[model samples]
Target: MSKYESVYIARQDFSTAQVEALNEKLNETLVGLGATVAKTEYWGLRSLTYRVKKNRKGHYTLFQIDADKDAIAEYERQMRFNEDVLRQMTVKVDAFEEEQSAILRNRDERGSRGPRRSGPRQ
Candidate 1:
Protein backbone atom coordinates (compact mmCIF):
# COMPACT_ATOMS: atom_id res chain seq x y z
CA MET A 1 0.00 0.00 0.00
CA SER A 2 1.08 3.57 -0.67
CA LYS A 3 0.30 6.82 1.08
CA TYR A 4 -1.48 9.41 -1.01
CA GLU A 5 -3.38 12.64 -0.64
CA SER A 6 -6.39 13.74 -2.63
CA VAL A 7 -7.55 17.33 -2.86
CA TYR A 8 -10.81 18.10 -4.57
CA ILE A 9 -12.97 21.11 -5.22
CA ALA A 10 -16.76 21.07 -5.27
CA ARG A 11 -19.07 23.64 -6.80
CA GLN A 12 -19.38 26.72 -4.60
CA ASP A 13 -23.16 26.84 -5.02
CA PHE A 14 -23.64 23.52 -3.25
CA SER A 15 -25.42 23.61 0.11
CA THR A 16 -23.73 22.42 3.31
CA ALA A 17 -25.73 19.20 3.23
CA GLN A 18 -24.75 18.62 -0.38
CA VAL A 19 -21.11 19.12 0.49
CA GLU A 20 -21.36 16.64 3.35
CA ALA A 21 -23.02 14.09 1.10
CA LEU A 22 -20.30 14.41 -1.48
CA ASN A 23 -17.66 14.01 1.20
CA GLU A 24 -19.38 10.94 2.59
CA LYS A 25 -19.56 9.34 -0.83
CA LEU A 26 -15.89 10.00 -1.38
CA ASN A 27 -15.03 8.29 1.92
CA GLU A 28 -17.19 5.30 1.09
CA THR A 29 -15.56 4.91 -2.28
CA LEU A 30 -12.09 4.93 -0.79
CA VAL A 31 -12.97 2.43 1.91
CA GLY A 32 -14.67 0.16 -0.58
CA LEU A 33 -11.46 0.04 -2.58
CA GLY A 34 -9.53 -1.23 0.49
CA ALA A 35 -8.10 2.17 1.33
CA THR A 36 -7.71 3.56 4.81
CA VAL A 37 -8.58 7.23 5.06
CA ALA A 38 -6.49 8.79 7.80
CA LYS A 39 -8.06 12.21 7.83
CA THR A 40 -10.22 14.62 5.88
CA GLU A 41 -10.13 18.39 6.10
CA TYR A 42 -12.52 20.94 4.71
CA TRP A 43 -10.79 24.08 3.52
CA GLY A 44 -14.14 25.79 2.89
CA LEU A 45 -15.32 27.68 -0.12
CA ARG A 46 -12.67 29.88 -1.64
CA SER A 47 -11.90 31.73 -4.84
CA LEU A 48 -10.29 29.69 -7.55
CA THR A 49 -7.16 30.66 -9.42
CA TYR A 50 -9.15 30.22 -12.62
CA ARG A 51 -12.71 29.32 -13.49
CA VAL A 52 -13.70 25.65 -13.66
CA LYS A 53 -16.97 24.53 -15.20
CA LYS A 54 -17.87 28.25 -15.49
CA ASN A 55 -17.45 28.79 -11.76
CA ARG A 56 -15.04 31.26 -10.18
CA LYS A 57 -15.02 29.66 -6.73
CA GLY A 58 -15.24 26.21 -5.14
CA HIS A 59 -15.28 24.37 -1.83
CA TYR A 60 -11.98 22.61 -1.22
CA THR A 61 -11.61 19.32 0.65
CA LEU A 62 -8.49 17.32 1.44
CA PHE A 63 -8.08 13.63 2.18
CA GLN A 64 -5.12 11.70 3.55
CA ILE A 65 -5.35 8.09 2.46
CA ASP A 66 -3.31 4.90 2.34
CA ALA A 67 -3.96 2.38 -0.39
CA ASP A 68 -2.54 0.56 -3.34
CA LYS A 69 -2.25 2.04 -6.82
CA ASP A 70 -5.46 0.33 -7.92
CA ALA A 71 -7.37 2.01 -5.12
CA ILE A 72 -6.28 5.41 -6.32
CA ALA A 73 -7.24 4.57 -9.89
CA GLU A 74 -10.72 3.59 -8.78
CA TYR A 75 -11.09 6.75 -6.68
CA GLU A 76 -10.10 8.90 -9.63
CA ARG A 77 -12.53 7.08 -11.84
CA GLN A 78 -15.38 7.76 -9.43
CA MET A 79 -14.45 11.39 -9.09
CA ARG A 80 -14.42 11.81 -12.85
CA PHE A 81 -17.91 10.38 -13.05
CA ASN A 82 -19.26 12.68 -10.35
CA GLU A 83 -20.71 16.00 -11.52
CA ASP A 84 -20.38 17.61 -8.11
CA VAL A 85 -16.58 17.42 -8.14
CA LEU A 86 -15.21 20.42 -9.98
CA ARG A 87 -11.55 19.46 -9.86
CA GLN A 88 -9.33 16.91 -8.18
CA MET A 89 -5.69 15.98 -7.73
CA THR A 90 -4.04 12.90 -6.25
CA VAL A 91 -0.38 12.69 -5.31
CA LYS A 92 1.83 10.02 -3.78
CA VAL A 93 3.83 10.68 -0.64
CA ASP A 94 7.42 9.85 0.27
CA ALA A 95 8.83 8.68 3.56
CA PHE A 96 9.26 12.22 4.76
CA GLU A 97 5.63 12.96 4.08
CA GLU A 98 4.53 9.88 6.03
CA GLU A 99 6.55 11.08 9.00
CA GLN A 100 5.17 14.57 8.68
CA SER A 101 1.63 13.24 8.50
CA ALA A 102 2.18 11.27 11.71
CA ILE A 103 3.37 14.44 13.44
CA LEU A 104 0.44 16.47 12.21
CA ARG A 105 -2.08 13.82 13.20
CA ASN A 106 -0.57 13.56 16.66
CA ARG A 107 -0.77 17.31 17.03
CA ASP A 108 -4.38 17.36 15.99
CA GLU A 109 -5.32 14.55 18.36
CA ARG A 110 -3.56 16.31 21.24
CA GLY A 111 -5.21 19.64 20.62
CA SER A 112 -3.44 23.03 20.90
CA ARG A 113 -2.27 22.66 24.49
CA GLY A 114 1.41 22.73 23.61
CA PRO A 115 4.03 25.23 24.66
CA ARG A 116 3.23 27.64 21.83
CA ARG A 117 -0.21 29.16 21.52
CA SER A 118 -1.70 31.26 18.79
CA GLY A 119 -3.67 34.53 18.77
CA PRO A 120 -3.65 37.36 21.33
CA ARG A 121 -2.99 36.63 24.95
CA GLN A 122 -5.24 38.26 27.52
Candidate 2:
Protein backbone atom coordinates (compact mmCIF):
# COMPACT_ATOMS: atom_id res chain seq x y z
CA MET A 1 0.00 0.00 0.00
CA SER A 2 1.17 3.54 -0.76
CA LYS A 3 1.26 6.44 1.67
CA TYR A 4 -1.19 9.30 1.34
CA GLU A 5 -1.92 12.58 3.09
CA SER A 6 -5.48 13.85 3.04
CA VAL A 7 -7.29 16.91 4.34
CA TYR A 8 -10.94 17.83 4.51
CA ILE A 9 -12.69 21.06 5.41
CA ALA A 10 -16.05 20.77 7.09
CA ARG A 11 -18.82 23.31 7.39
CA GLN A 12 -18.03 26.00 9.97
CA ASP A 13 -21.20 25.46 11.99
CA PHE A 14 -20.07 22.04 13.23
CA SER A 15 -18.94 21.78 16.84
CA THR A 16 -15.66 20.08 17.71
CA ALA A 17 -17.43 16.89 18.69
CA GLN A 18 -19.22 16.75 15.38
CA VAL A 19 -15.97 17.14 13.53
CA GLU A 20 -14.44 14.32 15.56
CA ALA A 21 -17.34 12.05 14.75
CA LEU A 22 -17.01 12.75 11.05
CA ASN A 23 -13.33 11.86 11.11
CA GLU A 24 -14.05 8.69 13.06
CA LYS A 25 -16.54 7.60 10.42
CA LEU A 26 -14.00 8.16 7.68
CA ASN A 27 -11.33 6.30 9.64
CA GLU A 28 -13.67 3.38 10.08
CA THR A 29 -14.28 3.36 6.34
CA LEU A 30 -10.55 3.21 5.67
CA VAL A 31 -10.07 0.42 8.20
CA GLY A 32 -12.93 -1.54 6.68
CA LEU A 33 -11.19 -1.25 3.32
CA GLY A 34 -8.04 -2.83 4.87
CA ALA A 35 -6.24 0.51 5.02
CA THR A 36 -4.22 1.85 7.92
CA VAL A 37 -4.83 5.32 9.24
CA ALA A 38 -1.62 6.70 10.68
CA LYS A 39 -2.63 10.08 12.03
CA THR A 40 -5.75 12.17 12.24
CA GLU A 41 -5.44 15.79 13.38
CA TYR A 42 -8.03 18.48 13.82
CA TRP A 43 -6.57 21.81 12.76
CA GLY A 44 -9.47 23.72 14.35
CA LEU A 45 -11.78 26.24 12.75
CA ARG A 46 -10.04 28.64 10.40
CA SER A 47 -10.96 31.41 8.00
CA LEU A 48 -10.94 30.53 4.34
CA THR A 49 -9.30 32.76 1.77
CA TYR A 50 -12.56 32.56 -0.16
CA ARG A 51 -16.02 31.17 0.40
CA VAL A 52 -16.73 27.50 -0.12
CA LYS A 53 -20.30 26.22 -0.27
CA LYS A 54 -21.12 29.72 0.98
CA ASN A 55 -19.02 29.14 4.10
CA ARG A 56 -16.46 31.73 5.18
CA LYS A 57 -14.85 29.51 7.80
CA GLY A 58 -14.31 25.77 8.10
CA HIS A 59 -13.06 23.09 10.45
CA TYR A 60 -9.90 21.57 8.99
CA THR A 61 -8.98 17.92 9.55
CA LEU A 62 -5.94 16.04 8.31
CA PHE A 63 -5.41 12.35 7.71
CA GLN A 64 -2.27 10.42 6.93
CA ILE A 65 -2.83 6.88 5.77
CA ASP A 66 -1.23 3.92 4.10
CA ALA A 67 -3.57 2.47 1.57
CA ASP A 68 -3.90 1.12 -1.93
CA LYS A 69 -5.15 3.21 -4.88
CA ASP A 70 -8.62 1.72 -4.62
CA ALA A 71 -8.87 2.63 -0.96
CA ILE A 72 -7.86 6.22 -1.58
CA ALA A 73 -10.38 6.52 -4.42
CA GLU A 74 -13.12 5.27 -2.19
CA TYR A 75 -12.11 7.75 0.49
CA GLU A 76 -12.41 10.66 -1.93
CA ARG A 77 -15.77 9.43 -3.11
CA GLN A 78 -17.00 9.38 0.46
CA MET A 79 -15.83 12.93 1.01
CA ARG A 80 -17.68 14.16 -2.05
CA PHE A 81 -20.95 12.59 -0.96
CA ASN A 82 -20.80 13.92 2.61
CA GLU A 83 -23.01 16.95 3.04
CA ASP A 84 -20.99 18.44 5.92
CA VAL A 85 -17.75 18.51 4.00
CA LEU A 86 -16.89 21.64 2.04
CA ARG A 87 -13.63 20.56 0.42
CA GLN A 88 -11.24 17.62 0.52
CA MET A 89 -7.90 16.77 -1.02
CA THR A 90 -5.67 13.75 -0.98
CA VAL A 91 -2.17 13.31 -2.33
CA LYS A 92 0.12 10.35 -2.85
CA VAL A 93 3.32 10.71 -0.84
CA ASP A 94 6.56 8.79 -1.11
CA ALA A 95 6.75 8.49 2.69
CA PHE A 96 5.04 9.75 5.82
CA GLU A 97 6.69 12.36 8.00
CA GLU A 98 7.10 11.46 11.66
CA GLU A 99 6.72 15.10 12.72
CA GLN A 100 3.42 16.77 13.35
CA SER A 101 1.94 18.78 10.50
CA ALA A 102 3.29 22.28 9.96
CA ILE A 103 -0.02 23.82 11.00
CA LEU A 104 0.08 22.12 14.43
CA ARG A 105 3.77 22.77 14.83
CA ASN A 106 3.22 26.48 14.25
CA ARG A 107 0.45 26.47 16.83
CA ASP A 108 2.72 24.81 19.42
CA GLU A 109 5.50 27.30 18.71
CA ARG A 110 3.18 30.22 19.31
CA GLY A 111 1.98 28.73 22.59
CA SER A 112 5.52 28.01 23.76
CA ARG A 113 6.60 31.63 23.34
CA GLY A 114 6.34 33.65 26.54
CA PRO A 115 3.80 36.42 26.78
CA ARG A 116 4.92 39.93 25.88
CA ARG A 117 5.87 42.33 28.62
CA SER A 118 5.62 46.13 28.57
CA GLY A 119 6.35 49.39 30.50
CA PRO A 120 10.01 48.78 31.21
CA ARG A 121 12.32 51.81 30.86
CA GLN A 122 16.06 51.32 31.47
lDDT of 2 at 81: 95
Q: Give the Cα lDDT of each candidate.
A: 0.85, 0.95
Write the residue-wise lDDT of candidate 1 on 1-122 in tens digits.
99898889999899877888888988998999999998887767889999999999998888889999999998999899989899999999863243444535765667766666679999
Measured by TM-score, the strongest candidate is 2
TM-score of each: 0.77, 0.92
- TM-score of decoy 1: 0.77
Q: Mind giving the per-residue lDDT tens digits that candidate 2 earns over 1-122?
A: 99999999999999999999999999999999989999999999999999998999999999999999999998899889999999999999998889889999999999999987788878
